[model samples]
Target chain A: EPEVTQTPSHQVTQMGQEVILRCVPISNHLYFYWYRQILGQKVEFLVSFYNNEISEKSEIFDDQFSVERPDGSNFTLKIRSTKLEDSAMYFCASSEIADTQYFGPGTRLTVL
Target chain B: GESVGLHLPTLSVQEGDNSIINCAYSNSASDYFIWYKQESGKGPQFIIDIRSNMDKRQGQRVTVLLNKTVKHLSLQIAATQPGDSAVYFCAETPITDKLIFGTGTRLQVFP
Candidate 1:
């Protein structure tokens, strides 16, 4: 089956530096989303993208965070200034519609 | 506040037995619900889903029950195996198409 793929399975970055996590969603999917899971915490929604724009975002998705579909297949999340609290496993998901989301393996971000 | 949650934080089951994980959702307007399994260091894998219009749905080795009146959902795994060990989560999406996730329940299948 076709699956969502994420690059850089794990990343380590310095605090105050910039980081970008990349994802390639299922080819035919129209809606894309980003979610994060802190250690020992529930997975939280970050943002949703559709029709080439952001549909909704949570408080965690502040000005420091931005998502881009720079190409037909790539969805990228960039953090302007990383913080220790920002370290978590970031998952990218996509669906033909919003009801059933298929997730990628996830990218583990570690900021020291 | 979280829109969905589990009744138990952890459950242990013997191999060959059946495992039932329960979740409660607060959104009366939610139209779709999904259960996911996440292993260590991986993402949430889709297990099964049910729409508000249906009371029950079945997949291979799994079943989902939805009760609109009580705002509850549950996943039942038949013939539980050690490979089934993972953290399970339930997510709800209202008509607006935004997903709200629940706190997960860890399942351990003992040999």
Candidate 2:
């Protein structure tokens, strides 16, 4: 079955540095989302993208975070300046319309 | 303040036994619910989902039971195997498609 895929399975960056996590969503899907989970916490929604624009976002998605669909298949989440607390497993998900959202393996971001 | 939550933190089951994971939601407006399985170092994988209009839904060896009145959901796995060991989370979609996930319940299957 087709699945969402992410690049750079693991990312290590210094505090205040910019980091970009990339995802290639399932090809025919129309909606894309980004979520994060702290080491032992529940996954939290970050942002949702559709039609090349942000459709919805959560309070945790602050000024430092931005998402882009630079191409047909590539969706990216960029953090302008990372903080130690930003370290977590970032996941990308895609769905067709209102169907079940399929998740990628996730990219582990380690901010030091 | 409304959120999704699990009833248990961990559950251990013998191989070939049936396993059931329960979840509760405080949001009355939620119209959809999904169950996901997450192994170590991986993202949540879709296991099954149910809509508010349906009371029950079944997949290969999995079944999801939803109770709108009590606002509870449960995932039942038949004849659980070792590969079923993972952290399972229940997510609800209240208004928008963005999912609100619950604290996961770890399922440990042993032979």
Candidate 3:
């Protein structure tokens, strides 16, 4: 089965540094989402992208966070300046419509 | 299939036993519910899903039950094995299609 794929399985960056997490969602899917799971915490939604624009976002998705579909198949999440609390497992998901969302293995971001 | 939860609320079950996990969703507008299993170092894997219009749905060895009145959902695994051990989470999506995940319960199977 086709699955979502993410690059840089793990990322390590210092505090206040910029980080970009990349994901290639299923080719035919139209909607994409970004989620993060802190260690020992529940998965939290960040933002949703569709038609090359952000359709919805959460409070945690503040000024530092931005998502881009620079080109087809690639959905990127950029953090302008990272904080220690930003360290978590960032996941990318996609769906044909608003139905079931398929998830990627996730990229572990470690901010020190 | 043997009975589970012979001990505390640890959610540990014996291999070859059946397991039933329960969840209480928060949204009355949520018409769709999904169950996902996440193992260590990996993302959540889809198990099964049910719509509010349906009371029950089955897939392979898994079954999902939905109770709209109570705002509850449950996942049942028959003949659960050690490989079935993971953190199980229930997610709900309203009209927005944004999935809200629950606090997962760890399923640990004993040999």
Rank list by lDDT: 2, 1, 3
How does each model score on TM-score? 0.98, 0.99, 0.95
Best by TM-score: 2
The digit string of per-residue lDDT tens for model 1 on B5-80 reads: 8999999999999999999998898999999999999999999999999999999999999999999999999999
Clashing pairs in 2: none
Of 2 and 3, the candidate ranking higher by TM-score? 2
**Can you tell me which runs of candidate 1 are displaced by over 4 Å?**
none
Per-residue lDDT for B1-111 in model 3, tens only? 111111223488999999998888767888888899999999989899898999999999999999888777888999999999999888888767778888788899999
Listed per model in order, the count of residue pairs whose N, CA or C atoms clash below 3 Å is 0, 0, 0
Which ranges of candidate 3 are over 4 A from the true structure?
B1-9
What DockQ results do all the predictions give, each relative to the true complex?
A: 0.87, 0.89, 0.70
As for DockQ, the candidate ahead, 1 or 3, is: 1
Model 1: pairs clashing at backbone N, Cα or C within 3 Å: none
Chain B TM-scores of the candidates: 0.97, 0.99, 0.90
C-alpha root-mean-square deviation, each candidate:
0.9, 0.6, 4.7
lDDT of 3 by residue, A1-112 (tens): 9999998899999999999999999999999999999998878889998888899998999999999998887999999999999999999999998689999999999999
Residues A1-112 of candidate 2 have per-residue lDDT tens digits of 8999998999999999999999999999999999999999999999998888999999999999999998788999999999999999999999999569999999999999
